[model samples]
Target: MGASKIGSYPCEEIVVDIVVQKSEKIFGELDVPPSKLYTQFATALALLAEGKSTLKQPLRTKDTLAILRAVENMGATVKRTQEQLSIWGVGRSLRPTGNVIDVKNSATGIAMMTAIAALSPRVSVITGDAQLRARPMPHLLKVLNNMGLKAYSTKPDDSPPLVVLGGDVRGGRISVRGMNPSLIPALLIPCPYAKKKVEFLSCGDSLQLNLALDVMKAANVKVSVGKKLSIPNQPYRPFNLRVPSDLSAAAPFVVAAVLTDSKLKLNGTDLASDRGAVLLNILKKIDVKVEVSNKFVLVRGPQQPRGTKLDLSLTPELLPIVAVLAAMAKGRTTISGASEARTMKSDRISAIAHGLRKMGVKISERKDGLIVEGQAKIKGGEVDGCNDHAVVAALVTAGLFADDKTIVRNRAEALQTSYSRFISAFQELGAHVGYAE
Candidate 1:
């Protein structure tokens, strides 16, 4: 699989279909790295344009590699030296050979591939693993549809095996509701290349807004945000970005520290990072002591304080980890303003409720959020990951204080999407853990 050919790249598929057996010992101190969510996507897209791009401190995850591989498949040249990645894009257009693009379990790869395919004149079919196919794509689809591009699932219920007819996009006003802001970058990247101006109407608050703005600015697109956006008909520059360590990935460890009454510190995590401050506020309400410096967050826990209601619409990624914390707090906690959260993952709140219930924890669902009753003690038992990364992380966090050993099946299945070394990180923190191959 040389990097120059369009259709000769070798594809390796990996599958894990069992529970992750829990380690008896709890985790100890550990130092985590920076956020990498936006960096990887930005790099892959940069490789689509005909220019040289420099990406710094990029995320080195499987999804990042998947995106890079797709870019390589489309005839781009990417070289990595030390900590920097240099990509020479294939130019302004991709000649799609009507190839079948398989993205495996990478959601970032799927989203970026969808956008990149929009630039091609050929009909492209994009497919992934079963779980990746099951994730929602309506928000991305709606925006693409508004641009006069036809994108639909190859299977029923809008699951992937997505068929994209790439051509000139007739861009116009589009309204997106109940969608995560973190996903907006995937939509916005391709709009500038469209012939017409694209107007984006959103519900005003999304944590990914700052990241989207950053990407737009990097690409030299002038974006003005008020209630609505009026995109201009201007040529934008190609972009290169350095993605930080994913705060979303760091959240579960934050919750784990809180639950186990330990003093934990996360380095290379920025308070100015999207949703970090909001998560800190929520943890504060639950009496988790936190101190933020320029480069890290020092969290001291074991507060045993009362729980408070939260509106998690802006930070849906925090839901799974927060759910576990809320279940262990002293009083009932309510999380609202997150009806859109369900759109991200249909089984999210329900899955948490089910896992907690099985562990003898009390929780209920509301119209817009969840209501959780804290338990004095959580009795560990067998749990299912539901093929969601956050769910798997939450189960592991819960295992920290369980009365008995907690086992999480299919936890490793989600590592392909995010946090590939999650289990290894647990081991680094002194947790007793192992994986069965």
Candidate 2:
């Protein structure tokens, strides 16, 4: 016997039983909203800063709300209204509200805030929901522990429900696997206040590190990149910036525009920021005709998506919908360099492959990547969301050209994880997307 096929996937894809209705075309004009990651980062950075900062037109979704709550517990002043978010940074003066900071189901929230909590002189327990607990706590714990934060978990598996006995973070040189893109920045969030310079060596050598480093650079953290990042003692400077639209959220619509005979306008996004920039670059590389302006990204897709090898190493969030787009594109599409996606909120790699396989697309799975053979027609069948948001969105995008009815199970609610306006946006674009009540 080789290996048990039981629980060895990059993630656990629990099949849900749902259906998709076909649409003749896609068209819409909507502001593709600001980055939740940026919004959440503003909260964290604000809490770590010396003054107040405002996040304009930020996404106040479940995930960002989770981060807000965690920081609020850590004494970050957050006042929310319909238009903007205000964070009053108490800097290193923050004290833990309780012994535990519950990040709900957000891994990014918990992981990013965990490092901040470790800077406190009091012991703080950072934990989250079942999905969050199941995800890895990232390999950064060893460095944090060595840095005088004393981070640990009962399972000792580097996953969550972690307890960090606080002390002065004597920041020193540490090495990390860059595959978990969030981990590097998470560790760095509080390092500026640490007693010493925090140097980082990328053990995994993932190229995604640049994105995280850009985020840090935006926050005014001095990160010198080489074989190791030499970060000196720095101050958290106040930043007044606009958060750009999310590229991860922009993917399905981009796919919708390309696969259907409709034009879609993504407002408030110019393809200049991280998630949005990365996705648009990939789309451009594949010869998708998208016009990027200062205020909005004008995209009209009805052209057959051409096949190309996409490396999703830095942007693992694109794995699901990218796979869906690849399935419908012309020729063969190869996606590589995203092995870490195996352990996202779900194992996205296996989930995308499994879902596509249901709708009659030929897919070959590797430990880290996937190969999709583009077909002229999308066959009608059922697929599972694997209870993952990315999987759900991927399956939904694939359903636009699906013959007759296509069902996606265990994913309707996961839409709130990222975009609450997903179905409505598609519906506005003339797609037959709705709830199955």
- The candidate that wins on TM-score is 2
Model 1: how far is 281 from its true place, Å?
Answer: 1.3
Quote the positional error of residue 420 for candidate 2 in Å: 1.9
Q: Per-residue lDDT tens digits of candidate 1, residues 165-260?
A: 878667788787655566666666677777898887873656566676666677667777888766666544566666565545678777766555
Per-model RMSD to reference: 6.2, 7.5
For each candidate in the order shown, give its overall lDDT on alpha carbons: 0.67, 0.74
Where in model 2 is the C-alpha error above 4 Å? 1-19, 203-220
* Candidate 1: 10-residue stretch with minimal lDDT: 1-10
Q: Could you give me the TM-score of model 2 versus the true structure? A: 0.90
